[model samples]
Target: MSRPLTATINLAALRANYLLAKRLHGGKVLAIVKANAYGHGAARCAQALAEVADGFGVAAIEEAIQLREAGIRQPILLLEGWFEASELPLIERYDLWTAMHSLSQVADIEAATLSRPLTVWAKIDSGMHRLGIAPSDFPELHARLEATGKVGKIVAMTHFARADELDCDTTPRQSACFMAAIAGLKVETSLCNSGGILAWPDLHGDWGRAGVMLYGGTAADRQLPDWPQAVMNLDSRIMAVRELSAGEPIGYGGGFVTERPTRVGVVACGYADGYPRVVPSDTPVLIDGQRGRIIGRVSMDMLTVDLTEHPHAGVGTAVRLWGEGLPAAEIAASAGTIDYELFCNVKRARFEYQG
Candidate 1:
């Protein structure tokens, strides 16, 4: 048959995670489905969450349009807003919500005439300087958008730069700035990302955007009482197994050399399949339900694992790259990256969705 590699998307777990976010925050949740639902397949994941989510968040207008085409009826927020004025029409046609982060975006929104007034999220750059107007400029911008009468409800929002760090003071400082900026405004507010939703309960407002955690990725310093279920199980199979003598080098560049008699299993997964090639030799992998350590530099199509501890594992032995019993966060940490990158980088595996 075809390659014994598959990326299984767990729809039931995805729904449960969304509901968990709702229960934890006790507010409307803008399910962050940007970057293809953090690479879990946006259309499928969004459809699964459509019934319960307050709304969905995407990185741009194109993603929102794609969801609309897929029959997703939930309100989709453009987290990064429109890139150009031309996208404003599509945003209006799709009935999408836009974030006004820059003065130029505000100008573009004001100049466009739409069939209905558009909902806007006035973004303030409390700490993250990547996108958003300064706190000092938020008042005038909000007033300007309101005066145009072309906008519907305007929600004040900001992104926390250090919500994941429990010891960091940046979140509190940014929250204070945002609070001061929108102190007397009549608009509702949102500031919590997944980390904020879990760690800083006070930051949850009219809306909380849940991203990585909804897919079973960790966001805080400590584990919570309610951990999200893993929504994607990346698996493969052992294609071959061999016995190696002491001092034998394995894989490319001799990155790993056997010190004693060892058994190795070649897994049908590698960097090309979105597995991190740079993962350290000690990174763990599961083969036939037994833990094994990667032994050498990962190749494009395959990688070798130390299977000496499990002599029963041979060709066709089940292998789990991440998810389910093995956490992606743990793998990512060993790879010098984050779970978000690992999820978004998956592109070469066959998909199997389960409810």
Candidate 2:
């Protein structure tokens, strides 16, 4: 038999989380399926939500093309726009919405020959200092895209830098800047990511990008008290159980030592399965539906969990690395990462999808 490791994608929970975003945001919501729906398998997740989602968001033209190939008929927006001039033709052929974040991208749009006008999302770098046109330059960008006569229905959008931080003023400041920049432009706008939707209802726009939250992730810790249901779980099993004395050292580098008699279960999951190797001792997991924790270095193929709390846990006992009962955010916090990274990095695990 294969290794007892699996990443179960919960499609019902996926739809629930998405509908929650749609209901809560009270506007058009684009399910961000970039990075293979954050590694939940884009095609399946997109199909599950195909009936309700306003559209989908991806990082580039390739991802959009993949969705189109998968028969995702809804609007697909390329969040990063085209990588080079050559991709413009593919963008047109796929009927994809492209984000115009740079003057060079504008030049490419102007010079391209197209079968029809394209939907454009005009990106404003109100904050985040990432891939977006400057607020000062947005007016010129809009004019140029319109002048080309190859663009139609420009949607103003911006990514929030600090929407996850409830106490931060950055979101409000950025929102004000974006609104001021787009004033009198008479274009629909998209400003909220998952964090923005959760925290600032007053700032909701014509369109919102539901990203991390769509796959059971979050606005992170601030909204942990009531984040939506997790859509995927990393499950594994104990391969072996070890009884050790108080002074025994565990795993690589002897970094963790037992202070008491310990019951350790070697889980069939490790860094190779996308569990973080740098996770310090006491990282959380679930054994036979009971709480457990990791206690040593994670090898490529296996890691040891403290099963002393559960006297009945042994080889073949079920284990959950994260999801459902055990949140991915908790494991990510222990590893000094985020749930997005944990989901995107999963590998070497059989997938089981359930509603």
Candidate 3:
């Protein structure tokens, strides 16, 4: 038997999440499986969701090619589109749908001479201002792509700048801006990310891209069209348990001191294993399905959790850092970080799949 220092991935939960996202979009769902499915293993996650998802979205062309080679016949939308001119041929070969955001990418697409017409998506710079062509340039780019004869279906896409901010006005502004730019062309539209799909229902368009929400993480307050199930549980075992007297310091720099007689448990996971070191003292860790708080600085290979409240906790007890009743967002909030970073930072540890 292996130690409990492993991540358990639930494929059934992932499929349920896919269906939830699809129901919310009220159209075809383009599952965002980039960043190795947000650190849940891209290939496996994609394969698990293949029957439920209409398509897949990845940040790189290489990832799409990998899926294609694996016999995943679904359409793959390249979120970053072409990084360089040399990637054009590979994009065509894989039948990838490129999200065209810059003039150089447009030029690369026009210059490439492939056997069949390549599908191109015109990404508008709505409000993120990170990539995508300006609205003023959209019409000209659309004209050039139309003239290229090598271009196939052209969908207009934009990302919301503040869809997660429930009270922010940016989502609507970006949505209006995107709609105004594509009003004339009337091609397929994809403006909603996970946040928009859940919080701003009006922003959902012809296609919807769901990422974090499909993993049971909330981006906004709105209820999911279908309930998204938690897909991963990060757990470990208590390697050591000890009792401490009043005022005894715990871990490095004495970040935590026992206020009274206390019992503590040490888990075999730390920053090296992707558990954040910056998590404040007293951040919650789970033991025997009860909550225990970290009582000291998170060390490189272990973290100390005060089990004074749960005296029955002992060595070899399973400790869940997140998942189940403890959501990743709650842990992230205590760590002064966000859910996305925590999800993507899962280190090189063994994983057990339950779904």
Per-candidate TM-score against the hidden true structure: 0.98, 0.97, 0.97
Please name the candidate that would achieve the greatest TM-score relative to the true structure.
1
lDDT tens per residue, model 1, 219-284:
887576568689999999999998999999999999799999999999999899899999979799
- Cα lDDT tens digits for candidate 2, 306-326: 988899888999999999899
Sliding window of 10 residues with minimal summed lDDT for model 3: 221-230
- Superposition TM-score, candidate 1 onto the true structure: 0.98
lDDT string for model 3 (38-143, tens) is: 9888888888888878999999988898788777899999998887889888887778888878876777767777889888878999989998899888888888
Superposed model 1: Cα runs more than 4 Å off: none
In candidate 3, which residue ranges exceed 4 Å CA deviation? 1-3, 224-228
Tell me the alpha-carbon RMSD of every candidate: 1.0, 1.4, 1.3
Top-lDDT candidate index:
1
Candidate 3, pairs of clashing residues: 11-355
lDDT of 1 at 18: 88
